[model samples]
Target: MNALTVNLRSVLELTDEQFFQLCQANRDLRFERTATGELIIMPPTGGETGNRNARITQQVMNWTDADGTGIAFDSSTCFKLPNGADRSPDAAWIQLARWNALTEAEKEKFPPICPDFVIELLSPSDSLKVAQEKMKEYIENGVRLGFLINRKSRQVMIYRQGKEVEVLESPATVSGEEVLNGFVLNLAMIW
Candidate 1:
């Protein structure tokens, strides 16, 4: 199913703590909040999508472990962006310094900072346009690099701060550039 969005700004403005409590109470549903106070409920992925997501997360996590310069996160980790939007990229990585700066409580809740790198793998229920918009939001919120990967289209949209979006068609691998430093994602597993 596609995501369902609810505009709750008119009735109630959810405080950060209230939102966190709401999320904690609803453990089964994945939720995201827009900067404008719209709540989005996302559906779970299918088997194929889940497998691909695992591979993508594993690769990034392994790289992060080896690189020793950053921390990696899976889809379940939501981050509170600078613009007040709560986002959870499919796979994400944050520089060690940025992550270390967070207080223990901040780290316990949705991280209060954007990731240095983010990857959004398009699932059957996801909209490419929406994913593209999210990538742009990441850049705007200080993400150094972002990728919107479409397996069906075998395409990857690379987003870099202060640079134009770059499209790669059927690339076997995509580099993390300076942001990730020596990390490369193998698209064959994702495809």
Candidate 2:
């Protein structure tokens, strides 16, 4: 059997302004700001991982509409955090009320607010520790819910404010609980 070679690049630490400029320059790079003020820029996904993430995002979006909660967005969209940081999740959601409260201009421009829910799909090249830290940061920054989807193990870890983190393994369904009422996503379907 032949060994597969993985090309991993060193993570470049960046300031908030530098991170913004990097984002502006590279349309394909995805950036995540760590709680300790480190910036991680990752290359775009290819092959199975990308397809799985896209399928999961679509499933979540469909579940949101079927549950009658609000709108869901794929990774292409970015959310502006309270701090001067902009990060994109694999998937995001916003309730109708909070979204409607935004001004037309705010809606048109990047909404300077945290998403109601965030999902991070793990890639082979991703650092699990870094991803989990980012998810924690999102919760601290006012994201009501977060899901860390690990494709390797096919597990979904759910995070909520003032509660213990819940790990929902494959063959189980993850629910939004009260944060997004009536929204239930089956892990098996997406995985």
Candidate 3:
């Protein structure tokens, strides 16, 4: 006898409240919003991608923990942008003071404010153009620093306020500068 296999397609397109409710009900769902406000729900990562992100998040956490400068969150957390958009960056960092000012309930809910630093990791399914546009949205919405990490090319593009975006090629490092003092990330180690 031969066994049949089935692959369940993920959900796509949802209302804002429906998206939040779905996320609350399912801890494993990874939700992202497009420029057109459509919701994309994806299954959790399986192997290398998950491991790499875990390591990178740890590095970010360690740096923040030591310096007491910011708080970091993995992709599961969502940030509410200025334009009524909800974004889930691969990783995010918010300044300590700003984070501390929120009430406990506010911390429990989706943050209504922008993060100081946002990081997006490129997956095989992601479009670089779309990712760059999302990064620009974050910057325009008050994100002081943003990094787009492309594992395929081992490059990181740094976005800062009132300046041209800077791309760091392989073997270089990215810093948070004034946004997150003493927070430095080496792309070589991350990829």
Candidate 4:
């Protein structure tokens, strides 16, 4: 889905509570908060995009479930990165140790931690530049691994810590590498 970014820093700074309340009151739109306090208002995905996102999330969740090493999250779950940015990756997984360290109250709100792995599936309306920026932000926030998948161009930009991004063209699948251990995402459904 395409997102409408509102630069509220010029108008007024919103407290964490205010941002949380605003998000809760507008359940129709998906929201994200940047480290700079900009609000990203994303529209609901179209049917095709929604189905693709679901498949991606299901695949990741299946691996996480069987591996029993981490917890999987869908698009609706937001994570408050250590840098203070609230982001919602299309598919994400945090290591069991990291997740267990969170207090119950923190878990109830946006967990203040970065996921070990994250996936962003590009919808038709999504801007590639914006998505790339988001992926970079994830990496800067300490995400160990991230994937920016573009079905239109059949390309995937792979991001890993301490390495330059690796771009693939028309790949049939994406490997989880050492970070995800045994997880290998099958791209047939999403592609």
- Model 1 stretches with alpha carbons more than 4 Å out: none
- Residue-wise C-alpha lDDT for candidate 3, range 1-191, written one tens digit per residue: 11122222254455556657777997855666554565656556657778878877887888888988678898888876768778888889998889999888778777777898888887766678878988899999899899888889888888998789988888567877887787788666667
- Candidate 4 regions exceeding 4 Å error are none
User: Lowest-lDDT window of 10 residues in candidate 4?
Assistant: 1-10
Q: What order do you get sorting by lDDT, best first?
A: 1, 4, 3, 2
Worst 10 residues of 2 by lDDT: 1-10
Each model's backbone clash number: 0, 0, 0, 0
Model 3, residue 88: distance off in Å is 1.0
Estimate TM-scores for all models.
0.98, 0.79, 0.84, 0.97
lDDT of 3: 0.77
**Which of the numbered candidates is closest to the native, going by highest lDDT?**
1
User: Which candidate, 1 or 4, has the higher TM-score?
Assistant: 1
* Candidate 3 residue-pair clash tally: 0
lDDT of 2 by residue, 5-77 (tens): 2222256455555655666787766655544455555677868778878877887788887876677888877
Ranking by TM-score: 1, 4, 3, 2
Where does candidate 3 have its weakest 10-residue lDDT segment? 1-10
Q: Give the root-mean-square deviation of each candidate in angstroms.
A: 0.7, 5.2, 5.7, 1.0
